[model samples]
Target: MRPQENYMVIISPGLLVQLMERTGDGRSVSVRELADAAGCHPSKIDALRNGRREKSTIDEALAIAKRLGVDLLVLWEHTGRTVPVPAEPPHIAAVPA
Candidate 1:
Protein backbone atom coordinates (compact mmCIF):
# COMPACT_ATOMS: atom_id res chain seq x y z
CA MET A 1 0.00 0.00 0.00
CA ARG A 2 1.13 3.52 -0.70
CA PRO A 3 2.15 5.61 2.27
CA GLN A 4 -0.13 8.49 3.19
CA GLU A 5 1.11 11.93 4.12
CA ASN A 6 -0.18 13.10 7.46
CA TYR A 7 -0.41 16.76 8.37
CA MET A 8 -1.73 18.56 11.40
CA VAL A 9 -3.30 22.00 11.27
CA ILE A 10 -2.53 23.71 14.55
CA ILE A 11 -4.91 26.49 15.47
CA SER A 12 -4.69 29.28 17.99
CA PRO A 13 -7.56 28.87 20.40
CA GLY A 14 -7.37 32.45 21.60
CA LEU A 15 -7.30 33.87 18.11
CA LEU A 16 -10.15 31.64 17.10
CA VAL A 17 -12.29 32.90 19.96
CA GLN A 18 -11.47 36.50 19.10
CA LEU A 19 -12.23 36.05 15.43
CA MET A 20 -15.46 34.32 16.19
CA GLU A 21 -16.55 37.38 18.12
CA ARG A 22 -16.40 39.53 15.00
CA THR A 23 -17.28 37.92 11.73
CA GLY A 24 -17.78 39.67 8.40
CA ASP A 25 -21.12 41.05 9.59
CA GLY A 26 -19.52 42.36 12.79
CA ARG A 27 -21.50 39.86 14.84
CA SER A 28 -20.63 36.84 16.88
CA VAL A 29 -21.29 33.39 15.45
CA SER A 30 -22.39 30.49 17.63
CA VAL A 31 -20.53 27.25 17.96
CA ARG A 32 -23.30 25.32 16.26
CA GLU A 33 -23.31 27.72 13.34
CA LEU A 34 -19.59 27.55 12.96
CA ALA A 35 -19.65 23.77 13.27
CA ASP A 36 -22.28 23.56 10.53
CA ALA A 37 -20.16 25.75 8.32
CA ALA A 38 -17.11 23.67 9.12
CA GLY A 39 -18.98 20.39 8.51
CA CYS A 40 -18.22 19.20 12.02
CA HIS A 41 -19.96 18.82 15.32
CA PRO A 42 -20.61 21.72 17.67
CA SER A 43 -18.60 19.95 20.35
CA LYS A 44 -15.57 20.03 18.11
CA ILE A 45 -15.87 23.75 17.73
CA ASP A 46 -16.39 24.15 21.43
CA ALA A 47 -13.39 22.01 22.15
CA LEU A 48 -11.22 24.11 19.89
CA ARG A 49 -12.60 27.37 21.22
CA ASN A 50 -12.13 26.32 24.80
CA GLY A 51 -8.61 25.13 24.18
CA ARG A 52 -9.49 21.52 24.79
CA ARG A 53 -8.02 20.74 21.37
CA GLU A 54 -5.36 22.36 19.25
CA LYS A 55 -5.04 20.26 16.14
CA SER A 56 -7.51 19.77 13.30
CA THR A 57 -7.69 18.34 9.82
CA ILE A 58 -6.91 20.56 6.83
CA ASP A 59 -10.50 20.56 5.64
CA GLU A 60 -11.87 21.73 8.97
CA ALA A 61 -9.27 24.43 9.21
CA LEU A 62 -10.06 25.69 5.71
CA ALA A 63 -13.78 25.70 6.32
CA ILE A 64 -13.43 27.57 9.61
CA ALA A 65 -11.09 30.08 8.02
CA LYS A 66 -13.47 30.60 5.12
CA ARG A 67 -16.44 31.09 7.41
CA LEU A 68 -14.46 33.63 9.41
CA GLY A 69 -13.63 35.52 6.21
CA VAL A 70 -9.93 35.32 6.84
CA ASP A 71 -6.94 33.53 5.45
CA LEU A 72 -6.01 30.16 6.86
CA LEU A 73 -2.79 31.58 8.26
CA VAL A 74 -4.78 33.97 10.40
CA LEU A 75 -6.05 31.26 12.67
CA TRP A 76 -3.96 28.17 11.99
CA GLU A 77 -0.34 27.31 11.38
CA HIS A 78 1.25 24.27 9.75
CA THR A 79 4.06 22.87 11.84
CA GLY A 80 6.00 19.69 11.51
CA ARG A 81 9.38 18.25 10.71
CA THR A 82 10.24 19.88 7.39
CA VAL A 83 11.96 18.04 4.61
CA PRO A 84 15.26 19.79 4.06
CA VAL A 85 16.16 20.96 0.58
CA PRO A 86 19.39 19.68 -0.87
CA ALA A 87 22.07 22.20 -1.82
CA GLU A 88 22.00 23.33 -5.44
CA PRO A 89 24.59 21.88 -7.81
CA PRO A 90 27.14 24.15 -9.43
CA HIS A 91 26.28 25.39 -12.93
CA ILE A 92 29.10 25.97 -15.39
CA ALA A 93 28.62 28.71 -18.00
CA ALA A 94 30.69 28.79 -21.18
CA VAL A 95 31.87 32.26 -22.07
CA PRO A 96 32.67 33.30 -25.65
CA ALA A 97 35.95 35.08 -26.30
Candidate 2:
Protein backbone atom coordinates (compact mmCIF):
# COMPACT_ATOMS: atom_id res chain seq x y z
CA MET A 1 0.00 0.00 0.00
CA ARG A 2 1.19 3.49 -0.79
CA PRO A 3 1.67 5.79 2.16
CA GLN A 4 0.00 9.17 2.23
CA GLU A 5 2.22 12.13 1.48
CA ASN A 6 2.28 15.41 3.40
CA TYR A 7 2.37 18.93 2.05
CA MET A 8 3.69 22.11 3.54
CA VAL A 9 1.33 24.75 4.90
CA ILE A 10 2.82 28.22 4.57
CA ILE A 11 1.78 30.73 7.19
CA SER A 12 2.10 34.39 6.34
CA PRO A 13 3.83 36.16 9.16
CA GLY A 14 2.53 39.57 8.17
CA LEU A 15 -1.04 38.36 7.80
CA LEU A 16 -0.82 36.47 11.09
CA VAL A 17 0.44 39.55 12.86
CA GLN A 18 -2.33 41.63 11.34
CA LEU A 19 -4.97 39.11 12.31
CA MET A 20 -3.63 38.92 15.84
CA GLU A 21 -3.70 42.67 16.11
CA ARG A 22 -7.44 42.72 15.61
CA THR A 23 -8.22 39.61 17.62
CA GLY A 24 -9.09 41.32 20.88
CA ASP A 25 -12.09 43.63 21.01
CA GLY A 26 -10.46 47.08 21.12
CA ARG A 27 -7.51 45.45 22.88
CA SER A 28 -4.43 43.67 21.54
CA VAL A 29 -4.26 39.89 21.73
CA SER A 30 -1.48 38.31 23.73
CA VAL A 31 0.67 35.48 22.42
CA ARG A 32 -0.40 33.23 25.27
CA GLU A 33 -4.05 33.99 24.62
CA LEU A 34 -3.77 33.28 20.95
CA ALA A 35 -1.79 30.13 21.64
CA ASP A 36 -4.43 28.87 24.05
CA ALA A 37 -7.16 29.62 21.55
CA ALA A 38 -5.25 27.88 18.81
CA GLY A 39 -4.28 24.92 21.03
CA CYS A 40 -0.57 25.49 20.45
CA HIS A 41 2.43 26.85 22.25
CA PRO A 42 2.81 30.60 22.71
CA SER A 43 6.27 30.42 21.13
CA LYS A 44 4.74 28.96 18.00
CA ILE A 45 2.46 31.95 17.56
CA ASP A 46 5.28 34.35 18.39
CA ALA A 47 7.50 32.74 15.76
CA LEU A 48 4.82 32.89 13.11
CA ARG A 49 4.05 36.50 14.00
CA ASN A 50 7.71 37.49 13.90
CA GLY A 51 8.46 35.61 10.65
CA ARG A 52 10.70 33.23 12.48
CA ARG A 53 8.45 30.34 11.43
CA GLU A 54 6.75 30.01 8.09
CA LYS A 55 5.29 26.51 8.17
CA SER A 56 2.56 24.90 10.29
CA THR A 57 0.48 21.74 10.37
CA ILE A 58 -2.91 21.94 8.63
CA ASP A 59 -4.75 21.35 11.92
CA GLU A 60 -2.71 24.05 13.62
CA ALA A 61 -3.33 26.46 10.77
CA LEU A 62 -7.05 25.73 10.80
CA ALA A 63 -7.27 26.19 14.53
CA ILE A 64 -5.42 29.49 14.35
CA ALA A 65 -7.55 30.75 11.48
CA LYS A 66 -10.75 29.66 13.21
CA ARG A 67 -9.72 31.36 16.43
CA LEU A 68 -8.91 34.56 14.53
CA GLY A 69 -12.34 34.57 12.91
CA VAL A 70 -10.97 34.20 9.41
CA ASP A 71 -10.89 31.58 6.71
CA LEU A 72 -7.89 29.22 6.59
CA LEU A 73 -6.83 30.61 3.23
CA VAL A 74 -6.69 34.11 4.66
CA LEU A 75 -3.53 33.45 6.61
CA TRP A 76 -2.30 30.02 5.60
CA GLU A 77 -1.75 28.42 2.23
CA HIS A 78 -0.68 25.06 0.82
CA THR A 79 2.69 24.94 -0.84
CA GLY A 80 3.88 22.77 -3.72
CA ARG A 81 6.46 21.20 -1.49
CA THR A 82 5.56 17.65 -0.51
CA VAL A 83 7.13 15.19 1.87
CA PRO A 84 7.04 11.73 0.46
CA VAL A 85 6.21 8.89 2.79
CA PRO A 86 8.81 6.18 3.07
CA ALA A 87 7.96 2.82 1.59
CA GLU A 88 8.23 -0.41 3.50
CA PRO A 89 11.05 -2.85 2.94
CA PRO A 90 10.37 -5.66 0.50
CA HIS A 91 9.87 -9.16 1.81
CA ILE A 92 12.38 -11.78 0.70
CA ALA A 93 11.43 -15.35 -0.07
CA ALA A 94 13.46 -18.07 1.68
CA VAL A 95 14.78 -21.02 -0.32
CA PRO A 96 13.35 -24.42 0.73
CA ALA A 97 15.95 -26.80 2.20
How well does each candidate superpose onto the true structure, as a TM-score? 0.73, 0.66
Record all residue pairs in model 1 with backbone atoms less than 3 Å apart, i.e. clashing. Answer: none
- Model 2 per-residue lDDT tens digits across residues 3-23: 643433545678777777885
lDDT of 1 by residue, 48-82 (tens): 88776666667888899889888888887764666
lDDT of each: 0.74, 0.68
Clashes of each: 0, 0
Q: What TM-score does candidate 2 reach?
A: 0.66
Best by TM-score: 1
Candidate 1 to native Cα RMSD, angstroms: 15.3
Q: How much does candidate 1 score in TM-score?
A: 0.73
Q: Best candidate per lDDT, number?
A: 1
Candidate 1: worst-modelled 10 consecutive residues by lDDT: 84-93
Candidate 2 backbone collisions, by pair:
none
